[model samples]
Structure formats: C-alpha cells, structure tokens
Target: MASDTTNGTRTIKITGKEAMLKNKSYFKTSTGDEAGCAPKKGVVTSKIKGKVYYTAWSMDVKFEGENVVRHMDLMTHNHASMPGNTPTWPYLDEMAVSKEEGPCKDDIKKEKEACKEFTPHKADGPSPCPPDGKPSTKDEADAYADKTAAKECLRARRCQLSPYAPTGKQPGCCPGQTGHHVVEAGSFYNVGRGGSNSTAIEGTANYNADKAPCICVEGCNQYHGTHGLMHTYQSTAALNSGATTQALPLEGGKQTSVVSLTYKQAKTFGVDAVGKSFPESKCEPACLEAQLDAYHNKQGIDDSTQCRSIATGYKGDEAEKAANAAVVARSSRLAAASASAPSGR
Candidate 1:
C-alpha cells in the first residue's frame, strides 16, 4: 500500500487477495508459542503516552509476567508511565525509617499499592486470594489447600513467603524490599528480617503467620532462599539501562527486564569518592554488600546484579539470577532462616 501526502490517497498493492494471512503461510519466519510464568527481573519499566517510562513493576513479583503484562498493556499499562502514587502510609515522615531509604515517596507508595495484587496462576504468581484475606470459608480453605497456591497467595498478600522450615524466614516484604516500606501490611510498618538496616527486607505480614504457605514449607527448603533476587531486583534503574516496552512481551517467560535512570535521579547520589563528580547510581554499602553476598552465594562471582533500588529511587532494572544465588547461600544459614521448598540437597 502507498499513501499520497497531498491527496491523502494512493494506489495500493495486495499480495494475498485470494488467501487469508494465516493461510498464506509463506510469510512465516519462525514457529512460536507462549506459555509459562515470567520471572521477576533486576529491572522493570512501563510505557507512557507512547514514551517509555521506568519504575518498580509490582512489589509482589515473586512471579512476573502478569504484573508486567498489566503494566505493559495498552489499556492498563500507563496511559501514563511510572510513579504517580496516591498517599503515604504514615501520613508524612519526620524521620527516615529504612536504613536503605532515600527519596521518591510517590513511587514507593505506588509500588506498595501494586504489591497488593498478584498474578493468578501457578507461575508468575499465585491464584488470587480472598479479597478480604481470609480462609474461613470452605472454598477459601480449599483454595489455600494447594501448598504452592497458598505460598503464592501469601506472597501476593505481602506476607512471609514461608513461615517455618528448620528455621525462621526473613521478612520478605518491601516496596523497595528494604528495611522500610512504602506502605504497611498491618504490622509490616518498617522492619525487615535484617532489622532496620539500610539493606534489610520488609518483613512478612503479621496475620498470615500460620497460613498453609508458611506451614507446609517448614522442615524443607529454606524459604525466601531466593530473596536476594527480589531484594536486589526490586531496586535497579538508577542507571541508564531502563527497559524498553517494545521488548517487554506479556506472553513470554523471563525477559531481560531493565530500567533507564534519569540523570536527575542520579544526582540524588550526591558525589563520588573523588567528591568532584556524581555517580549514575546511589550505591549504599549495606545494599551493595547484600548484592555481593547474593552473587557469591550461589555459584560465586555473580551474574546477579542490582542498581539503585526503590529504596533510593525507581530508576533501574532487576534480574532472576539472585534467586538461584541465594539457594546455595542458605545452606549454612538454614538453621536460622528458611527456604520455601526442599533445599535441593
């Protein structure tokens, strides 16, 4: 087909007039199919007004795809782009709660709001739990009967991923996955398994402490064994690597999510070791040390990475490598913390 700029019309060519597009077949370049859950990445983004915008996808991304899809779609995906949250949980803060805390309150609140929901599937997330968050009904009880679903549901609820193992689990909750949270889940006010350190994770919910997801996983795999993954992943983007929505396919599994940090967000880091220049990232020793331990935990050296977490600002990407890394690292720590499944030993 051709267009005439002046007349607004032009001659057109049709190659498959006699056949359907699918029936034509010759246009096919490859065979493709869509299936499976999407993994939480070290980075994430959304599209806004035809422009690309970056920010945390959802805090409840133990499973990916669904939230990413919701954020990537035409209708739901940012008629806007990133960070335009409502109100804060604590009204307005007089003191910084998270040791890893920085600015970007609106972004943090929005992420916490997003974390309220989750993917309704076996992968990416759990089957939707009760809107009221109760398993008192027979149907609700039955729904939670599925061990995996219960865990995912708890994850969706921002509760502990697993409650008991041979050990206690870190509070795996966070908008930024830091010691502080953008919002509160009952008592998840501003604390993590690591206490109130800059790198501590937001702890699980107070109510679901005895849920099936927490109980079933005990005496087995260390729960939150892969937390290092999300802990770092939810953080990235204070860099130049923000994601491209064109690349974020909702139907696919595990895409290499990324974020593009703004120079403005970068300036928040203040100055570098030389004191004459600003860094592209806001690297906190506590957070950096956590990332290094996560990388060194699994196989070592670390393909896992995170930059400028939500604690600093929502301007980076996250990856799945941290999950695999923490599995092995939990080996020695199992006596203290927990994993969600069998330790794979």
Candidate 2:
C-alpha cells in the first residue's frame, strides 16, 4: 500500500473497476499469447450471478465532438467491457478509511540514532588555534568533517553523498579505475573473419563511428559500445526520421497494399545518431502525420499569401579571415621562439 502525497488523506483501495482498467493492456489468449483488445461498442455490460449489473462505474464512456479525440479510462479496452468476474480476483465493493498506519515511532527513533553514528570519516580538521573562546559544537564538527570527506571523495573520483551519486556510499569515487575509458561487457569488435593470417586492427579497442556500429550498453543501457571503447548516451535520432511510401513485397513476388517510406526518405528523417535499423511500425506515425499535414496544405490552407523577409549582420567570411590572421600570428611567434633557442644538434 503506497501513499501518494498529492491526493491528500485518501487511501486508494484497488477496486474491480481499477483492476479491470489497469490490466486492460494485458490480455492473454487460450494459447497464452497476448493481443490488444478491439474497441467495444454500445453500453458496457457486466454479467453478475447469471444476471446483469448496471453499475455506472463499469460503463465505458466516449465523448462526442468534431476534432475531439476519444479517451478511455485506463482499463477500458477497445472491445471488452468489464472483466469477467472471478473470486480469485474479487472486486473491492467498498472503500473506507480507518486509523491510518505509518512506520512505528521506535523505528523512526532508531533510524535517527543510527544516522548519528554513521558519520562519514573526515580527512582534515581545523587548526588548534581557535577564535578567542568559540568552541565547535557537535553539529558544526560533523558538518566540517563531512565537507572534508566530500572534497577528498571528489579528488579521488569517488561517489558523492548527494542523491545523484552513481553508487550509494560515502562521497568517493569507484573502488577501481571504472571511468578511465572502459567499454560495456559482452561488447567487442572483430577486425575480420576468424581465420589464419587474420590480425586485429590497431586501435580496435576504442569506439569510432568510422569503424563499427554502436553497441548497446551493459547494465545501464545509456552508453553504446563500439570496437573496444564505449560512447556515452544513446541518441533518439532514429525514431524521428522522414516519410516512407513503398508497398511491402510479399512472397512469390506479390505486393502488399500497405505503403512504407523509401530508404532515402527514412535517412532524410532525423536518424543520424541512432543509426538506420528500426521497424517500419516505429516510423509509421511520424510519417503519416507529415503526409497528412502536406496533403492539407497542398490546396493552400490560408488564402492570404503572408510573406516577410529580414536580414541580420555581416557574413562570417570576415570572421574566417580574422581567424586565419590569428593563426599566422601564432606561427610567427613559434618561428621566433625556435630561432631564439640555442641549438646543439
């Protein structure tokens, strides 16, 4: 039973309505394979005890209006109404709040006491020479110790005490050389086919886009491995590519009615960083939206030929000239230094 701070003082009992809606996304077939349920039509029905229950909560409502999108409650499927009632998954008929429960006071006290003892070890302390009569309090001493420890942790490339620390420990770096260029596990590259006289290429351990395709991250899948080196962060560029308009080829040289984007068009879409391998289904929505927008505007969506033009600043050809001048100036300085140095060879 998780408590949410937003709703305020309300305990959410998992009801049949809620369960049916939540699990609507997951429907199993007789063979155990799952499929999306088609939309249900007309008034919703729930067969109860060989009879019907006209519960308003069970009704699947659809809004009516032009350009208005239809939204269903989380559990309502396309075809199925209320789920088939079963004792194993009984519906919560009612919900009421009694004395709410929370962590025991003793447990809270114990946690606070333990926190006091688990203070991070400090690496430095103030000099014995203190201000006239000011003595450091326990809280101030602990804070100073924590600050010193934090500085040491950063210097040693250890985890920080902050919430965003990679590992949950005193703010210090990883135990070993974890971040000094290491690729994800199970990710490696081969220079060529496995055979005699085959030697791996030099610098084959580092990731270079010119060399090989990106590899999926290991435990934390944000980075991609290539060759032997790893590149941080996967790009979503592939998902945002342009339109496709080709009929998929079927067996026996037949063509399917469905259209898809051409390879050129797909590449034209925003897919440089993410690479070129993705399912047609993934690119369909954006393609269709672009096509629809183009079709709508083909007839000139607005009669007014609204046009405006503006210019700003000089071209950067001058900036390039200035950069070249600076380079020449630096070359002159290097030549002067070389000439002034005494040579023995």
Candidate 3:
C-alpha cells in the first residue's frame, strides 16, 4: 500500500461524520461492459451485487471539512455499512490504505523485462506545473504542443511515489510526446506531494495513489485522437465505455476525456507498454530529433536543428532558438568534414 512518508507513517484517522465517498467513477455491468456509477443523492448503490461495488479504493472521499482527495483502500467493495449507520459520525470507519497503487514487487517480478527498460522520459517526469496540476498559463499547460495537450501533468517524483515507478514505466520523451494518466489525475487525484498515508496539505487528502490509478493508460482512446495526435504510448482500441469527461484541453482549442481502465483491462492493455511504437506521425525528422535530444541530450542526433521548432509547430521559445543554432552549427561542421574528405573514384 502507498503510505504517507512525511514523518514516515500514515496519520491514521477515523473518517469523521461528514466524509462521503464519491460515486464509483468506473464499473462493470453484469454483462461486463465498463460503465460509470452516478450518485443518487450522494451514495452509489451497487447494481450487480457482489460484482459492481464501486472501486472504493479508486474514489475520492469528501468530508464536511476534512475531505480526502486521494484513493482509498483497494478491495472488493462488498462490505456494507449498517442501515442506520451513515458511515459518517456516531459510528465511524477508518480510511483504508492505498490499494495496489502502483507496481508492487510481485508486479515488478511479473514484468521484470519491462521494469529493466523503465526510464523516466523528460515529458513523463516532474515539470513546472503546481501541485494541484492546474497550470494557470498555456506555457504551463504544454509548451511542447499548444493549448490543451492531454498528457497528464505527470509531476509526481519517483521519490514522491515512494515505491511506485511513476505509473508503469514507458522510459522515453517530452513536449512532442506525453504521459497519459490511466485513471484520471485531473483534480486532486492528480496533485500535491502528500504522502499516501498523511495529509501534507491541510483540509486536503494526502496525495498518494501512485497505485490507485495503477492502470498504465486510458490510452489508444480515440475520443479526441485528432487534437494533437500527441499520445503514442497506447493505441490498442477505442474507448467505448467507462466514465468520460473532457478533463483537459488540446491544441487548436480541442479537448479530450479520460476513459477508465480496470485493473484486469489494464493488464490486457499491457501496463508495461513494451510492445508500443512511437506514433508514425511523430517519426518525422524534426520530431525524432527533438525526441532523441530530449532522451539522449543528442540535439545533433541527426543533422536537424529544427527539432523543437517543428515539434511545437513553430512555436518560438528561447530554448528553441538556442537548440536550432546548435543544430545549425553541427550541420555546418558536418558539411566542412565532407568537403575535406577525398572523393571516391
């Protein structure tokens, strides 16, 4: 279970009277179709009995004043509170620790080959966005693309995630590429560096579900696939089920929502992402050069200095200027070397 490591212990508490669980965002119908559970008043009732209990561990808990924003204990949501028991005050319940929030030793052991290849891509690592993950400006949004890039504001530090490797590793890239958060990290589920076991931020749940959205990606989702064509980590199928929301924006003022992926479904989609390939569109000279430069610091990986420039569709920035100049200089050096070499007969 992901824990609050602030002082190094989960600051356990009896959920106060007002703590209310949000509707189960994603669920399976009796026939097993992915679907969403909505709150009638505030509580979500299971339709399929033992099969459709809300993903208690994957939901947010709201209290009168002590609202929790992170994921809850992972389990079969089979337990039911007493009829008169509101699950609030009077009689109370303790918050469950984060379920299998991210990859565990067993998980790692299961996917060792994929684990060995895990590398933190620049785009997938920490960025300048705030802990809430809501960027006030477009620059903070996604400077690489334009307004509304669907990539999750993957700002959690590996240290922050403690044991989890920032949502099943994909080891590579940024700007042109992005980290797609499988379980919607849009709001509180998306920010703050609080320990999974403690509330680092007052009045807010500790930010610890590195394993909650443990699912690798709600990817290959073509909901708004045309927005930026920026996501390359997945492309297995079209998301036709689960809860959908236009959580983030994209280039050209377009937007897209995240489709929920269950643990089993996530496994089916291959959390390792080992077999995925870069988007065919992103393999162009400029995109490739920028990606290579980001991955290996080889701006001159190819003779192209236009990596950043083209990747952002010509969005000018100071880094782009310097990068372009460096590429140009390298190109010149290569030309001079060619001229000095003896020609073949």
Per-candidate Cα lDDT values, in order, are 0.23, 0.22, 0.24
138-204, model 1: which lDDT tens digit per residue? 3332333232222333332332222222122122322212221111111111222223332311122
Model 2 lDDT tens row, 171-234: 2222211221111111111212213322222222222222111112111211111101112111
- Model 2, CA-based lDDT: 0.22
What lDDT does model 1 reach? 0.23
- What lDDT tens digits, residue by residue, belong to model 3 across residues 1-345? 112111211343444212223232212222222123522221222222222222222122343322232332222222232111011110001221222332122222222222222222121224322233333333333222221122222211110111113322222223232344321222222122233422221111332334222222112232222111222222222132232433433223443343433322332222222122212111122221122112111111112111110111122244334334533443454446457864211
Give TM per candidate.
Answer: 0.18, 0.14, 0.20
Which pairs in model 3 have colliding backbones? 4-197, 17-88, 17-89, 101-211, 101-212, 102-211, 148-249, 148-250
Among these predictions, the greatest TM-score belongs to 3
What residue runs in model 3 are displaced by over 4 Å at the alpha carbon? 1-60, 69-233, 239-345
Give the clash count for model 2: 23
Which lDDT value does model 3 have at 192?
25
